[model samples]
Target: MLGELWGTGNLFRLALPDTFLGYFLLLIDIIFLAAILLHFSRKTSFNSIFEKWQWVLGLSLAGFITSQLLPIPLPFTNQSLTPFSVFPLLLAASFLNPLAVLIVGAATGLGQSLGQTNQLFDVFHFAFTGLLAALLLQQPFIGRLYHFLRHPIVSGSISMILPAFLLGLSTLVISEAGFSLAALDQSLYTSNNALLLFLFEGFINGVLVLIILKWLPNLRPRQTLIPSPTQRSLRRQLIGNFLAFSIFITIVVMAVVFNLSISVSRRLVLNQMAHNAAIASSELPDFQSELERLVDAFDNTTLFTSSNPVEAEVSLEQIYNSSLLYNQLIVVNKELTISAQYAPGEPEKLQLSEEEKLALNAVFTTNDRKIVTKNSSSVEGLSFIVPVMDDGETVVAVIGRVTQLSINNLIVGIQGVTTDGVGFIVNEEGQVIAHPDPTMLNAYWQDEENGRSLSIETNGIKNGAYQFYESKSNTRQLVYYLQEDHDHKWTVVVSTPYAVVLDLSLDIGRPLLIILLVVVIASFIQLTYQSQGITEPITEMVTASKTMAAGGNWTPSIHAQRDDEIGQLSQAFSQMQRSMKKRLNDLSLLLNVSSDVSTNIDL
Candidate 1:
């Protein structure tokens, strides 16, 4: 927590290094190029060899403009593209070639830079998504993913996620490059604290892009190219999406499960601190009760007074030997003279605190006074004071023990219960008061230096107060705390960074992820088949249609056998050819008859 509290941290990037940045942007370009060369090579006129390029330019400009002008901005939010990007990319991807997409992607990247987070790191997403969709939509397998996921919007918005992830990863990599240690951490997101951010963005943007892609069919230029998301395609899309999603989700489950395992290191430390804190906290009440009982025992003793001068003074040695719970006892006359003193040590050498002396004086200042006080020992133990009374209702000397707040026995008991994870207690100021970590007592209440202490002022600790803070310095540790005003109302916090306590989600998620992965793979494979085989025929028909246009009359050259997309293309081509030929022949016959009749009937 040495960093700023209110905003994003080193997660922010100052500048981008080109070597990494280049790959991200280049990917977009290549995808664009593929779309242009393979799908929609622009053709203008017999002489304008490069007229198609104009569409590319138009789309690029459109992308730039939309990115710059996207109307809304989300909070603490990092976005790769804008809501307006949908409108333009939609228009461009639907109408322009791959080349246009690549160029447009560049423009979109630029726009997002200007209008969005603007960090050099932020552009990776802008570049990624722009290129990803451009290249990926051109892919049969990926396209199949689009269909199976039941998310066309994903196709539409993949532009947002890829770049966002790229940006996030880029920012993380670049910022962390110099630190050899952090790079070695197995928990990438945990070490970086960006796992949730990336996963969330990926999921949400994934869904959006999926939805948009799904919607593209009705909006495409070639109605033939867009297949109906009929039951079959839908089913395949569902399966593919399920599988891809499942893989990542499984990873997530693993993280959660691993997060809870105390064996990992951090959770173990936190639990110990919490347990110790609890012991120290709970011990105060027990000590208080003991002191109160002693006070009562002495208060009821109407044996001696200042006037009687403790007429029945008992021997100090006898009193000391007779008492089992007390370490020492003293009997004093009203003249402030000690008549007898029992000794755990040399009674003549025993001393009391100023506060304790004052409490005693308060009892002496008035008649029949009784007082209880606690004192801190400079070396060991605490001190308690209670004034004795006489039958005449007169005040006598005050006496009590010094070791009142010890928790050695309590700590031992707590340690026995400390099984998988340890627990401890933190004082109001985040100090490690009583810890399984013996070295921890009286320490500050922070996982990181100054963090807990600093926060205590802002976060007051009342009776039964609880809080948690992850160590920024130690990423794996989670400080779990429960403040219970149990008797003493101490803040009993249990720190368990491990998920063993709340990891039922992993149990549920593991199987779900597996099932999802299997389904997604199946769907993706099916989509690949559909694009390569089912839709291949239609694509071929398109090729044939081009060949027909290149030739003279349009004839049924398309040949397909299946009843799927390709077969439909062949049948359509055949029908169009028949209709055109019939019309052509009829026109020729009518023209010939008219010409002959005109000559024969010439006036």
Candidate 2:
């Protein structure tokens, strides 16, 4: 056993600090002092206290015998189970007073420890267990629990199950703590097998207790021993009404504040998004101009001027290496044949797609730069097509750079503005050209099924608008869009969900509600305590006055501690009682004299 205490150095070994141990001992001392005070104040007779002792002691002795004679052995650990020892503690806690319960617990722990290893640690273990169990099973809490269990409409299974479950939880704590304290082998204390055994034992003990209490109905708590205060005064009623009114007003104020805050927050978020969109619009044109200049310079090189595929290949590699943006740079000849491909190992004479061919024709015919986007199922992304003009101002070779617009990366500044804010770019054709979600790319701006569109034409707006769109998931999104008029004719879209904004409002409201609840509870407790100071004295005076009025030779004096209005009333009542007693005496004396004169006359 000594070796087990120090061996293996298992993880379960609790390195409790000395200061914590000192504080724990001090707390226990305080609790014991409190219990003593409580016990003496109640002041039950010695015989009654002794009778309780006898019952508890006998139950402890019985449990001791059972544990020793036929000890239940546990698997996976060298520990004997003695759940029966809990019976005395439970019994003492149920019907006996607090002091009696403690005594029973101490005795039972001592008896069990002595019978087993005679270890001081074992005694403390059982004693601590008893203390916790007794504390949980005391007075008002137990009374309330009993009432809940025995309600008229409650089912039998429910009544039994609830109590049993609660008992199991309490027993689990005791068992775990007891094992930790008594365990010399830390490995055994931390083992899964040990935990399972303790759980089983706790559950079994709880079920057994329920069965025992059921058979011995006397052990169960029937009703509350302490009487509840019943007197209600006008002041008390007013206080209650005022508290209710305050709570109602607080709730209404919070609701109004929440609505106002959400409105302001939503407007601010929309304004921020609009600001971000404008910034992106200004910045994107600069990026477009820079890219177009690069493409034009590359077109003027010997690579495209000489129409040499070999030279163009080398020049395209240099241009692709210049920026991180370009995925591929292609040089198309006057015949619309791919002269050279920069993105590695492609044939020199690749045929252009019908959409690309059409875009090439428009670039030559219009003699202006055109951004052509492919919204086909197989193809996506943008192509910037610029006409390479000869000295005679005729369109020669067309220079186009194939690149996907990454709105997710470009619009990263708007991410922290709102939790659910999103930004995307749409082309003139009303196809989603650039979006954070890859699945939405090349998909039409209008939902085919819902007929929801982002364009002003579909929404019946001239330039810009904020429209509500319900997705396939039935979630409503607040979309704010503005058209970019710089060479691309693309629309910049920023959106967020209405629910997310509302949740933000609720987030602020929840803490306020909690604060209100805490304040109300604290106020009620304080007011109740304060009310007692005034009401108790008044109640005493009223009772005493009633007794005096009923022909009893008694004086009413509250002897109020405070020098308030209640104290003055108490003093006046005392004076009135003295005066009334004197008058009654005078009347009695007169009656006696009259009676004596009548007797003389009769004689």
lDDT winner among the candidates?
A: 2
Per-residue lDDT value at 178 in model 1? 33
Best-performing candidate as measured by TM-score? 2
What lDDT tens digits, residue by residue, belong to model 2 across residues 1-603?
123321121232222213433345435645755676466557755566676667766765654443233345544334455555455555555566655555665565455445543422333344445445544444342345444533211222222232223223323333322423212112222343334543454445555656677788877656555532221464566566668677887879787877786666566666776778766666667556655765556446455656567887777788778765666677776677777767654534444556677878776676666665554434335566666677644344444444555434556654545666677776677877566666676676742233234333323322343534343422345566766554456677777765555566666677877788788788877887877877788788879877877866575455776678988888878878778778877889999999999999999
List, in order, the clash count of every candidate structure: 67, 0
- What TM-score does candidate 1 get on C-alpha atoms? 0.41
What is candidate 1's lDDT per residue for 136-179, written digit by digit as tens?
Answer: 44433324543543333445544444553455454444433333
Kindly give the stretch of ten consecutive residues in candidate 2 with the minimal lDDT sum: 179-188
